[model samples]
Target: MLFKDQVDFVRQHIKKNKLRVFMTILAATMGCAFLIVLASIGFGIQDTMRKEILEDQVITEVEVYTNDGEALDISKISAVEHVNAIVQRTRMDVMTVSQLENRSLEGNMALTNFAEEQKSNLKLSEGRMPTKDNEIIVGYQFAENLLTDAERNQMEQNIEEEAEPIGGYKESLIGKTVTMSLQSYESDEAFPENWNFTIVGVTEKPAKDWIVDTNILLDDSWKDKFQEVYNASVEGENPDLFYSSSKIYTSSLEHVKSVTEELKGMGYSVYSVSEQLEQLDVFFMAFKIGLIFVGTIAVLIASIGIFNTMTMAVTERTREIGVMKAIGASPKLIQRLFLMESAWIGIIGTVLAVIISYVVSFLANWILPMIVGAALGEDSFEELSMTFSLIPWQLVVIASVISISVAMISGWRPARKATKIDVIQALRQEL
Candidate 1:
C-alpha cells in the first residue's frame, strides 16, 4: 500500500471515532503532565540542595579537633596522608568597640588569625582582606553594636515604617576605626589597654549568621598575644598552642573520606560537610525515584485506557479489516497501520503535556519568590534563592519516548488481532 493511502486510512478512522481517540489522547496528556511536574520538583530540590552544600564550604574541607581538648598541632595534620592544607585559626573571644567614637559603641566579638599561607574561604564584599595587625575584616552585625541606642531605635523605626532590608548598616561601617579589647564581656580590665585598629574590609552577607556573626579576622601575629592573655585569665593545663578546632582541606573531594578516617585513627574527632553531601546524594536519588514511581502510576492508568480504546476499535472495524484483507492487504500492512495510528495519538498527547508543564513551571518559579519576599517583611534578604520547579530538556525527551512506547505496547494485541482476522468471520460483524 502507498504511504499516502495508509495515512489516509488512519485519518478516516481517527475522524470516525473522534470522541474515543480524543479521550485516549487526553488520558496520555494528563499522565505525561503529572510525570513532568513531579520530576521537575524532584530535580529542583536536588539542584538547590547541591548548591547550598557546595557554596557553604570547600568540598574538600574536613573540620578536626582533638579528643583530649588540646590544641591541634599543624605538624601532625600535615603529616597525615591525603591532607593537603592546614588552616590554624586562633580564636580569642573578646569584646570590641568602634574606637575614636564618642558614643562608646561596643559589641561581642571573636578574633581569628588570618595568614597569607592558607585560603580564608571567606567571600569579601567591600575593600580588601586585612593583611596587617592594625587592620580587620568584619562580618554581619559588625556595626550593630557600634550604633548608639538612639541610632538603633531609629534604624528599627525606619525598617518598621518603610520595610528596609536587614544588614543595611554594615556597608556604612567600612573604613571606620575599631578597637580590640581583651576584656571578657563581664570585666572592665583589658589586657591591651588601647590597641587601635582600622576596619579594612567587610564580608559578603552569608546565608547563615554563624558564618560571620560578630567574628573579625585579624593578623596571625596576634595569636600569641591572645593565647597569653587568655591563659593568664583562665589558667589551663596548657596555653592553647594552635586553634582548639582546626579546618583541614584535603587535596580533593575524593580524598576527604580518607583524610577524615586518618584523623580519627590519630585519636581526633573529625567532621566534614562532604560526608553529609554524600548521604544527601543517596537520599535525593531515592526521593526522585519515589516521585517518578508515583507519577508512573498515572501513566499506567492512561496506557490501560488507550489499550481498551484500541481493542474496542478492532471489534468495531472487523469488517473493514476483512474487506482490506480480501482486497490483498498484507498482515504486516494491517499491523503497521494500527501502530501508526496509536503513535500519532501518543505524539499529540506528549506535545500538549510539554506545553502545559513548562508554562506551569515558569509561573511557579516566578511567583513563589514574590510571595516569600512579601512574607519575610524586613528580613527578606535572608530569603532562599531557589525555584520550586525546573524542567530540563532531558525530562522532555524521556517523557515523550516513554509515552509513545507505552501506547505502542498497549496497542500490540489489538494490532495483531486486526492482522489475523478471517475474511468470512469478520465480514459477518454488525459494523
Candidate 2:
C-alpha cells in the first residue's frame, strides 16, 4: 500500500466514526495516564523509605570483635581496599564517685572520633563530640540517673515529659563541669585517682548496653598510654576482650559487607549493617511489584474498552471496506489501514495521557496534604514528608510504549476481519 493512500484512508475512517474514535482514544489515554500515576506513587514511596533507612544508618560499617583472646590487626583491616576509616576503642573501668551532692555513676571509658561510620548510629541530643580526652559524652539516661529525684521531676517539667531526655539533658549541661573521684581497679584491688569530667556532649540513649560505657574520648597515643596505666594500676580479668573490640568504617554502606566478609575470612567475629539493608531492599522490591500489579489492573480495563471500540468499527465499516476493495485497494492495504487507525489513536491518546498525568499528579499531591493536615491538626504532621507522585522520564516512556502496543493489539482481529471481507456481501450490508 502507498503511504499517502494509507494516511488518506485512516483520516477518512476517523472522520466517519468521530464519536467512537474519540471514546476509544479517551479510554487509551485514561489507561496510560493511570499507569503513569501509579508508577510514580511506587517510586515516591521507595525513595521515601530509602531516605529514612539512610537517616537511621545503613550497612556502611562493621564492628569487629575476637573469637579468641587476641587483637585483630587494625593495620590489616585499614589497608583493605574498601576501608574508609577505622576507629578502635580501648576501654578502662573507673568507679565514679560524685564530688557534688551525694550521687555517682560507674562506667567504663572509651575513645571515639564521633565522625565517620558510627556517627549516624549515635545521635547527639546537645553539644558535640569531645576533641579533648577530659571531656565526656554521656548517655541521657546515665546523666538522668545522677540527678536527684526532685531535680529529675523538675527537668521533666522544663523539657516536657515526652521530649527526648538525651537532647534535653545535653542542652541542659552544655559547658557544665562535673567532678568525679575515680577509683582504679586491678583485678580485685583498687586505688583512688581523682579526676574531673566536663559534660561536653550528651548522646541519645543507644540500643545496646555497651554503648552506655563509651563516654571518654582518648587519642591513639593517649589510648595506649591510658590503657597501659590503667592495666598496670588497676588489674582486671579478661583484659584481652577490650583489645578485641574495633569499629571498621567502609567507604559506603554497600562496602560494609565486603570488609566484614574479609575480616570473617581472616577469622574474626563481625557484625555489619549490610545484612539488614539487603533484607529491607528485598521487602521494598516485593512491595513495588505488588503496587505495579494493582495499578496495571486499571490500565487493563482501558485496553478492553479500546478493543470493544475497534471491534465495533470493523462491523460499522463493512461497506467502506468493500468500496476500498472495489477501488483496487488490496486486502493487505485494508489491513494496514485499520492498524494505522489504531496507531493514530494510540499516538493521540499518549499525548493526552501525558498532560492528564501531570494534572492528576499535582492535584493528588496538593489536595492530599491540605485535607490530611487539616484533619490531623497542622502541628501534628509538620515533620512528615511525603511525595504523593513522582513522574520520571522513564515512566512516561514506558507508559506511552505500553499504551500504543496495546491499542495495536486490540485492533488485530478487526484488521484481520476487514482483510477477509467478501466484497459482494459487504456492499449489500447497511450500517
Candidate that scores best on lDDT: 1
lDDT value, residue 337 of candidate 2: 81
Name the best candidate (by TM-score).
1
- For model 1, residues 322-422, the per-residue Cα lDDT tens digits are 99998999999999999898888888998999999999899878787777777876345335678688888988887788888888888888999889899
> For candidate 2, what is the TM-score?
0.73
Clashing pairs in 2: 59-273, 60-253, 185-234, 186-234, 186-235, 187-235
State the lDDT of candidate 2 residue by residue for 13-76, as single tens digits. Answer: 7898799889888888888887888788887776766666565543566878885657678678
**TM, every model:** 0.80, 0.73
lDDT of predicted model 1:
0.77
TM-score of 1: 0.80
